[model samples]
Target: MTRSAPRSQAAELELPGLVRDRVREGRAKAAATRARRHAEAEIAEESPVARVLVDVPLAHLDRPFDYAVPVAMAADARPGVRVKVRFAGQDVDGFLLARTTQTTHQGRLQPLRRVVSAEPVLSPKIADLAAEVAERYAGTRADVLRLAVPPRHATTEKEPSPPAGPAEPWTVSVAASAWAGHDPAEAYLHHLADGGSPRAVWQAAAGSVWPLLLAHAVAATAASGRGALVVVPDGKDVARLDAALRQVLGEGRHVALTADAGPARRYRDFLAVSRGAVKVAVGTRAAAFAPVHDLGLVALWDDGDDALAEPRAPYPHAREVLLLRAEREGAAALVGGFARTVEADHLVRAGWAHQIRPTRALARERLTVAIAGASDFDLERDPFARVSRVPREAHETIRAGVATGPVLLQTPRRGYAAALACETCRAPARCGACRGPLHLTGATTPPECGWCGRVEEAWTCAACGGRGLRAPVLGDARTAEELGRIFPGVPVVTSSGERVRASVPDRPAIVVATPGAEPVAERGYAAVLLLDTWLLLGRPDLRTDEEALRRWSNAVGLVRPGGRALAVGDPALPALQALLRWDQPGFARREAEARAEAHLPPASRLATITGEAGAVDDALTLLALPAGGEVLGPVPHEGGRDSEEWRAVVRAPRAHATALSSALGELQRVRSARKLDPVRVQVDPPSL
Candidate 1:
């Protein structure tokens, strides 16, 4: 027994030595592996740390972060290429902003997980532009990057389709344009041709060939061995500018970069611009950011169109982006439209741009305008129309004008009926399920929610418990139906919503359409009836008058030179007067003056803070408002009783715009830190 005990003790001692040996061996192997990893990292030390703006999309994490470049991935992790990294414990994609040896981050930087692409999707100029835009609009850099660079399509990058030549050759002379004689216009063109960035804000007579004028300017820029970019509002304007640019720059000089061109085609065109294949770019709003090389001129037509305001976050208007690009790139800018808005007028007023006016004689020669007053119509000519909504003068003008060509009737609304309201108390009817405002798409169809698409058959108004509904404002369909009954033999064609006709044959027809949906007549419309003018101007919006004038002029501009337009409203309003006398600039200047007096936009900067009532109130309390800034709300956001949402408006003088923006941005940063309820922040919203 004693001998066995000695052996057990010896065995136990040997077990401890064996365990220590195994532990030492494991430690040695781990140290060797770490040493090899350190050696590899040292080899990659030559590559700078990449400052990547990860696609986290959270407003709080919008800034750039430092990432260590590995030797294997350093070649492909160049600035502007998409890279994947471990962020918040998950691998995610990001855009490399810059590569630098120095970083401000205090923590140990994580290695870039992998390189996603080496295509340089973002350019240095675009990075700078996006940053400036983010600062200007109080948006995140990541948001703007999402807009500046499209998603990468591997197939599109691998192989591109053969470029197609223009269907016909284009060779229009710039000097033969309608505005050749205007000294300011001539000087602007000469400046572009001389490689100078002279800004011009041109106002053209409505019926004049304005697209041709723009094309001439673009051609002047292209003539100096530089590129030009022209951004319009929609596909129609894109087509017009595309056609005009083709006429001026010839085949293959420009590429249209609209999303409607399909992702592959758009990406191809973008690549073409990056490759210096095209010197001119024409498209919708997104084209304002087209990567045209050595951009000499940036022009936007009809900047007031709502389509010019991007629907995505950061929500930049094309005009603002173009303005910034022109400043940053030293590119000339042309901000012109049929009707001017306060923003454009502010540019001219501030002397940032010069006003380009056509000669009075030329304007008179090109535009013919008339007014149909409410009380001046002849009752004897057509009693039915006079007694009804349509005036006798409208009937007479349509009858006489149809002999020459088609007639356009512009209504304010688009549906079969105006939004339904309680017949008794005049309160707007709403859907029971979604609280969306109820609208009638047809006379017999049940009332449906415009937002939720819910049909509300058993709906009653909250106010007065009324069941009957009435349309306070007339709509295009109802107006068309009424007009069809009035003009029995005339072919009545309705154009609005999904069935918007781009152009009508030059024949006798009554074209009833909503605002922004007027069909172009081949030769020209014989006459235009600006119906429901009161509804247009009576809206409680800041840009109501401006929108009215823009719409009225756009419709009237489609009329033939000798034809007339009869507006069915008071003729004394400055907007109507502007149309009657072709005084858009004068009207815009006056509108700006009025807005300045009222402390509205253009003269002052405005921002809206909207969210849950408590959250909005708390945020406003934390705001560090600049001097001369006024806070004007906490009101119900939806203008309804029992509403939980609220809104606050901050107005600051033009001189304090920068301070105001900075303060708002700081407040947003603090809100993010506190993790407060989300609130939407918008600067200079098109509508108040």
Candidate 2:
């Protein structure tokens, strides 16, 4: 019995060791199996080294990495093809940028896991453009590539590309008369038809058929056997441009690429452009990267529209993208809008592009403009012109015009009483809970804080302790209600925000719309009322005057020839004067000069860094200011998502813009490498 007990105790002691040995043996076998499989995986004999752009958004890891291409993926692993690869011991998606005979990488390279698809979805030109855009915006290439390339859909990728349409010969005669109004317009078309790159900032005349004109330009380029890209501000513009393109270039010559088209449709349209099925691509901002085969012309409409500025990281402006594309591909550029922007004027002033606009005499004949309180006679006649939101002259104009055609009333805000003030003291009302501006969502609903959505059950004036509230700023809904009451039995329609209408009937009616939401009238409005001019011009923004003029001009452009546009502002205001005289270019020049003197954008380069206080401080510490550069504030900013964040502004001469961007980019890279929180770096932000 003693001997048996000793044997059992020895067996128990050996059990754990035997189990460990079995597990070690299994691991060794698995390792051997993996090694054998890796060794057996054949590498491509020719051009075995593949440079891949992994889909890592880390700024520090933005560059391409070397990977050995497996023999099985040789045919499929072409440049611009999507592939799965082992990156940092994890499977990741990447684009095969190029293949080389050998790589400079000295370490043992990992082979690609598999090719995502054999299709070369990303074009070399687009890849280059994306990289350039990233560098210019101080963003990672992966971020820009995400914008350039649509997400892959296996079904759509498997589908065959649409057959290319037969080429159509184009000539200047096709659109010569269409361009006769503006001097050199015919010349621009001829240059496009002749395959010459001419850069022009075109100021579209009032009531001008701009869609058709742009379509003519695209057709001219297409006739030259080169492609054209046109980017507008919104989906409504896309629809108009699409119709115009069909009218001029016929069907199947172009495809519209917009996020609204759904993923499958958007991807299909992108594939069509990449496969050379279509030569013309028109859409919103995302279409700026459309890979047109042999690009010839790149045009953008309404470059100042906020929609053209991407809201995502890096926040690239479509105008800059088109400009970059034109410079890179030697493509003609046309920056056309109802009103000229300072940036557009800079293009002309820099001799990079010429201005195409009608003579002052022609412009005056095309547009009839008036300003409330412009002259002593107007003020004396109305007696309340300066104090009234809708003056006697404006009301009379609307009353008379409604008999002829539609009348457009453009409001700067969209909701019902967008701002409230104390009636006794004229001080803006604020919520006690959050100190946010209180606004009425409707006539019956109580006022609520815009920022925190806290209901102000009983709000009192902070200054003067007034109990009554008065709407100092009226939105489209309130304006519409007032207009409806003023003009009884006259059909009134409101368009703004998410419920914006594309067009209104030509019949007699009153259309109250916010800026950028005005609906097109078939024959054009007989009269347009630019209401609440102070709302746009009074904003605490650097581009207040410019943006006000833009919105006013857009509304005025919807009026028919000889139609009246009455703006409710001091006639002497520069923006109003520009509209009154139909001289946007002159206004743009003067504004640009003023900005230049102030060392603002176009004349200088500016960047805004906003984030948490510590993050911002870290970025500032890392920032290497260029020569002649200045840093403006570390001010408390409420613009960031986090309430505790701050903002800093960096400024430099225009010549050192690239240097500033590079410095900011390096700061981001360092922060990323150190695993620090990121700060938003925006070059030439739309607003200050």
* Candidate 2 backbone collisions, by pair: none
| lDDT for each residue of candidate 2 in 1-688, tens digit (9 for 90 to 100) | 3445586456656678878677678889999988766653878899999999999989999999999987767888999899999888899999999999978889888888888888888898889998888878888889988888999988998888786565455568869877667878998998998889999999988888789999999988887889999999999999999999888887688999999999899989999998887888999998999999899999999998989999887889999999999998999999999999999999999999998998676687777898876452356554433433677788899999999999999988989999888878878899998799999999889899999999987888988988898887788898899899999989999999899899998899999999989999988899999987876887889999999999999999999877889988777788999999888999999999999999999999899999888999888888999999999989889654557879999999999999998888888888899999878998888988
Model 2, 420: alpha-carbon shift in Å?
2.4
Q: In terms of TM-score, how similar is model 1 to the real structure?
A: 0.86
lDDT of each: 0.81, 0.88
Q: In model 2, which range of ten residues has the least summed lDDT?
A: 376-385
Q: Rate residue 28 of model 2 by lDDT.
A: 95
* Per-residue lDDT of 603 in model 1: 89
TM-score per prediction, in order, is 0.86, 0.91
lDDT of 2 at 10: 62
Report the number of the highest-lDDT candidate. 2
